[model samples]
Target: MSGDPLERIAAALERLAPGPAAAPDWDAASAFVWDAHPDALHPVPEVSRVPLGLLVGIDRQRDTLLANTRRFAEGLPANNALLWGARGMGKSSLVKAVHAELEATGLKLVELQREDIGTVGRLLALLRGAPHRFVLYCDDLSFSHDDAAYKSLKAVLDGGATGRPANVVFYATSNRRHLMPRDMIENERGSAINPAEAVEEKVSLSDRFGLWLGFHACDQDGYLAMIRGYCAAHGLDVDDAALRAEAIEWQATRGARSGRVAWQFFTDLAGRHGVRI
Candidate 1:
């Protein structure tokens, strides 16, 4: 209805800009997924995660992360954690499992997808003054050469001027320790006038995390232990010798041995045994 050109332009811009994100019902669920487009938090009634005991071969990581999360939940000093290592080694699973284990401590789990990294500051703003503590988790996170989203992540990790909310902590899982491909880092070094500074700027994003837990590839024994643990947890009966022989063959065919592989193998074995997990 505005006749003036300036007023009309302003109205159009206002319509284009995204509205403020809605305040989430913190008590709605133990876990939530962040959606950037609509700027909302979708509650997850049932999060898919195995028990802490079922996770094998990464005891150090499990213990350390669990302690860190517990401390955060207790209102103690804690650091943002980065779980970086081999794929299918349970980086993201550990984050979820730790939160589940400590759910009674009044901690909340907020999952933010890698593509939603740019909107993290807005997400943090919504949680900044909330009463409950939050573990903002990003799974399978990494940055491409052209990606600038990592800068936004720094605001969450480093917490610019106002500083990160005491009630909120960040947890991210990535295969790369630096959250960048090796070739990308090398390219920065080769192209930039000051290679050190260039590389530092790119790699320093990972340094923001106070805790770095590395997950190595699982060995045959560890793999088998994971399978046995799953079987025991699910009450799936199997002979040790037969399980070992079949599991080894399964891994050999798949060409990798990790918690995920073990679980996949178990799923098939459970199905064959007519057992439900």
Candidate 2:
């Protein structure tokens, strides 16, 4: 009262802040991020993901992802997903896209990084009590020789005291089918007394994923089709022959064909034609 009304209110609020707080409860979060530095769950609201419709040239994979995602959102049993294979072929994109599609049905996608794989149990605990369905997504997930976080992942997937949340599903992408290097597996194969036992280390990790959706490099026809799809969707004015030639040239310069390459081609064509898309 002596100084200002605002100052008195601010001082009272400051006194209420918690000090030396205990670990945050997983049950309180609708979303959680694995902060590996402190090994904690950080809540987030907005997740970055593209629309499912923008994804092109992978019809089969798209349908599969959509079907699985819908099933999970509907409170039905769904598999833990593993999106593996070629890089930049829309594996990670599809996960985000599907998450967005399912949002209309009240499901959410929570993304975590590859390095934070060790904290999956903590994440699982948070999701365990969530009323909302969650899709835990990890992009570019893999393990090296010294990183043994796969064991924690395995336990959370099916072996932990608090099993995977009934309302949660996991989606991870990796270039390797077996989340470890071939040399690492081979070296273990050579050193171990039992080769079968040694290889199981890698196999068991992959085996945890109930669904395996593979992405591969696009062929010429497939690549062109993707370009045409983008052009049509964006309502860009370009004849098939002219568009085909330009897209081919773009891919040739890059020396490889993937979904990422196709999008880049579309971007350049859009600019050349003065299309705002």
Candidate 3:
């Protein structure tokens, strides 16, 4: 039988680019990111993270997260955590720090972007057979009213028969507690035939996460402490009195205090003082 001309062209393209089956070995990865285009996992050997000690004014949250992460790494029972609250309060930083701290103990961190939640199942599937423990880190993970991706996440998180691979834990940071805005849930309640049930269905997704760590805006004292901590860690030797004065002024100008704001102030301080931070 004669081969079709289209078939010959398709064969040529296949020879050039091939299918996902010809892709690199995913199991070789100590870490992975989910690629949704072809529903596959991309191998990543090294993760980008900040040191654990530099995250400040969150000792309670740090201790809780450290303990939970340690337990998971030790092969004990642990909860999937949701770190939520104020913007730039080190919610995402804490996640990366914890991952870095635990990596020496054989833990691996895989960062999945906010837009990749729907491909979570494919990522989970890829990790199920890997030897190292996995922390699925998603930063800034809130959803809008029209976004239906959370349903897919609900399935991957708890409903899959594979059921969140025993070697994996989820650590997500968000500006909202339930990963949805109050208005979204309120609108569902106002418009649905059965208000309570409709709200419950939309709200219950967060209930799947067993641990909730809330991050609030830092007080001036706490914020100053963080600035000093970063300054000290990075060897920026500004005098204590001047450091405090500048940190306070920086916060005042920003009209709010947070880890992010503190870091920004420190960066500017280091630049002006001709020191590294």
TM-score of each: 0.97, 0.83, 0.87
Q: Which candidate has the highest TM-score of all? A: 1
Instruction: Give the lowest summed-lDDT range of ten residues in model 1.
Output: 157-166
Compared with the true structure, model 1 gives a TM-score of: 0.97
**Candidates, ranked, TM-score:** 1, 3, 2
Tens digits of per-residue lDDT, candidate 3, 1-277, equal 5899999999888887624423346456555676666666677775655578888888899999999999999999999999999998999889878877876787877778889888787677667777678888888998998998887787546766657789888988888888898998988899999999998966888888989999999888889888888888888878899888878888899899999998899889889988853
Instruction: Single out the weakest 10-residue window by summed lDDT for candidate 3.
Output: 18-27
Q: What's the lDDT for all of these models?
A: 0.92, 0.80, 0.82
Predicted candidate 2 versus true structure: per-residue lDDT over 12-62, tens digit per residue? 888864332234554554445666565555766655555677776778889
Going through the candidates in the order shown, the clash numbers are 0, 0, 0
Which residue pairs collide, candidate 1? Answer: none
Cα RMSD of predicted structure 1: 1.2
Give the lDDT ranking, best first: 1, 3, 2
